[model samples]
Target: MTSFMEDYFRTALSKELAIAPPERDHEHLSSTSRLLEKQREVTEAETLLANQKE
Candidate 1:
């Protein structure tokens, strides 16, 4: 689980690094995608942890 979180963080960081300077709508879309990805990672991690508790 720790490894999974670490991987997700790394991927997010890479994506952020690769993002070019926002020019127009692309900027908004990129930001939104990143936010959604992060949210999904958090949700998945929480679910995994919860399952472990049971």
Candidate 2:
């Protein structure tokens, strides 16, 4: 209600928004999913090769 309170609230909200992580857009999520899937595949392949060595 007062000017000081309004300014304080605005500053706090700005700081929080700055510290928060960016929203997960579809493209970003898709790329991340693809990367994880590739990593999993590589690990599985490495495991299979190691087993074959035994």
Residue 25 in model 2: shift from native, Å?
17
lDDT of 1 by residue, 1-54 (tens): 998998788668756775443444535567778787668669877965775674
* Predicted structure 2: lDDT: 0.66
- Worst lDDT run of 10 residues, candidate 2, spans 18-27
Check candidate 2 and list the clashing pairs.
Answer: none
Error of 1 at 41 (Å): 0.3
* Cα RMSDs, all models: 9.6, 19.0
TM-scores, each model vs. reference? 0.46, 0.46
Q: Taking the tens digit of each residue's C-alpha lDDT, what string does model 2 give over 1-54?
A: 697797687668755765433444546567777687668669867965774574
- Compared with the true structure, model 1 gives a TM-score of 0.46
Clashes of each: 0, 0
| Worst lDDT 10-window in candidate 1 | 19-28
